[model samples]
Target: MDQYAVFGNPISHSKSPAIHTMFAKQTQQAMEYGVIEAPLDGFEKAVGEFIHRGGQGANVTLPFKQQAFALADQLSEAARLAEAVNTLSFNKGRIYGDNTDGKGLVADLKLQGVTLTDARILLLGAGGAARGVIAPLLSELPASIHVANRTEQRAVELAVQNPSSKLVASGLDNIEGEFDLVINASSASLAGSVPSIRGPLVADAVCYDMVYAATVTPFNLWARQQGASRTIDGLGMLVCQAAESFAIWRGVRPDVNPVMQFLRAQMTQSL
Candidate 1:
């Protein structure tokens, strides 16, 4: 059986193993997925050991993404753009890196019937999560993407780095103009808080929080309270990204709907 795992610090809470296991079973692939809680300073060593042990590929999470990017022998366009690697494949003594986060996000949005063509998007936060999705989001021909961060300079820097006329940056307090979609990529939701943006930004707009929980995420709940047209959490993104990685490793895509339904049921049961 092919061996795969997700590497991260404090990885015990990750659902990647379950997601990939379902993908493998659905696709009839002979593989086993697990988690590896690598030490913060020993990520590279851990990856080397995994490769030596005949590990086929691995998913990366949190603080290890950048390290994975640096460790790869080559990078996919998405990974190059994001400067992070969430998926890694090993073959012929080469490590290939890819970033499926943005693709997963876009796919989930489309699946949920959210329009992206010529839409105005407001992306909260300028961190890695935000950076990983901007390129993919731009590919959909959105009219514009306004990146807002707590630190104005960081948002400005991120915008400058991406360098697209359709992209703009601002501090949360200075956000202006209405958006067709509002995405919370900030860590606020992890703390059970919503971003500090004005509620009007979400009024009649679809709100997406890149954080998921047993119930509605804090950002999604707040968006609903503010009259958001619809709200989506990151659970779909997680499953979709895992499916992408599974396809990369197995050369076969698994049906996501049944897996999504299963995970949703599990979340509800945990509540």
Candidate 2:
């Protein structure tokens, strides 16, 4: 069987092994998927050894996405624009990288019954997670997109990275008015927290927290109390992104709704 895996530090909690395993069975592909605990300083070497052992592909997370971007012999257009790689494929002594996070997020929103065309979007965060999705988000041609970050400087810096559309950066404190969708791409929810921002950003908008939980995440919960239309966590995004990578490897697109439903049940049971 061909081997595939996800590489990261602090990977004991990852759901990828299970997600990919299920995809393999569903798609009837002969592949072995698992998780790899790559040392912070040893990402490249670990990947090198995996390829040597016939590893066919990898899903990267956290601190390694940029390094994976640097390691790829070639990158897809999305990867080049995001400057990050969450998916990888090996071929003929070369490694290829792709960023499926943005596509995943967009797909998740669609699964949640969202209509993205010509709508206002507020993206919270200016880091890699946020960067990976901006190009795809812009490609949808939202009426406007305002990126807000706690560190206003970083948000401003990132806003300049994608200059082709209706996008700009603002300090969270200065943000005013409403949006059609407010996506929390920040890692703040991992700490059981929400972004510190004024109330207007989320009011009347559907809230999307890129962090998922058995129950509504803190960000989504707070958005609910604020009278947001609806709230969705990141479980769907996770499944959608995984499907993208699976398609890249197997040339088959597995339906993610079933996979997402399963993961949701697992998260609920765990809690």
Candidate 3:
């Protein structure tokens, strides 16, 4: 059986194993996927052993994304641009890395009826997650894209490297104007918090939280009250990203819509 695993500290909460298992069963692909509760200092060793043990590929998460990015033999353009690697494919003694988070966000937005083509975009946060998605988001050619972070310098630095699009950096408080789409990529949402940007920042916008819970996340709740036209959590994005990795490793793109709906229903029922 082909082997795979997801690496993280508190990985007990991760849904990647179950997700990949579903992908495998749905496609009739023979594979074993599990979780690796890596020690804070042992990500490299854990990944090395997995590849050695016939592990075909692995998903990197949390504090190890930078380490995975540095350890890869090569990177996909998306991974290189983001300086982070969330997915690693081992082949012929070489490891190829790619960050599927951005791809997942874009595809999830499409499923939610939020079109980025020619629309104005407002991306919150300038951290690794934000960096991972910006390059792919720019590929969609939104009319304009603004990156606002609590730490202004970080936002400025991220904007300088990504000058291909009409990118601008601003402090969260200085965020002005409206956007057709707003993505809350900051882990703040996962921490049960939302950014402190003006409520008007989400006025008339379609808000997306990159973190999902059994119920709507704090970010989506705040966004909805700010006149957001639509609000969604990250369950769809998580499934979409997992499907992308499945397609990369197995060459079969499972219809994620059904899986997404299933997960949403499960979450709703649990609440």
Best by TM-score: 1
How many residue pairs in model 3 have overlapping backbones? Answer: 0
| Model 3: residue 207 alpha-carbon error in angstroms | 0.4
Please give, for residues 171-240, the per-residue lDDT of candidate 1 as tens digits.
9999999999999999787688878888888899999998988888888888999999999999999988
Evaluate all candidate structures by whole-model CA lDDT and list the values in order: 0.92, 0.90, 0.90
Where does candidate 1 stray beyond 4 Å? none
Question: Model 2 — TM-score against the truth?
Answer: 0.97
Candidate 1 has a TM-score of: 0.98
Candidate 3: segments with Cα more than 4 A from true spot: none
Give lDDT tens digits, candidate 2, residues 1-271. Answer: 8999999998988999989889888989999998999999999999999999999999999779999999999999999978999999999999999999999999988888887889899999998889889988888778988899988988888888888558879877878667999999876887898899877668889999999888888999999988898899899899999999999999999888788888888878988
TM-score against native, each model? 0.98, 0.97, 0.97
Model 2 pairs whose backbones collide: none
Local error of candidate 2 at residue 192 (angstroms):
1.9
Global fold similarity of model 3 (TM-score): 0.97
**What tens digits encode model 3's per-residue C-alpha lDDT throughout 1-271?**
9999999998998989878988888899999999998999999999888887899999989879999999999999999889999999999999999999999999988888888998889999999989989988998889889999999899999999888657988999898777998999876876899899889878888888888888778999999898999998889889999999999999999889778777778878987
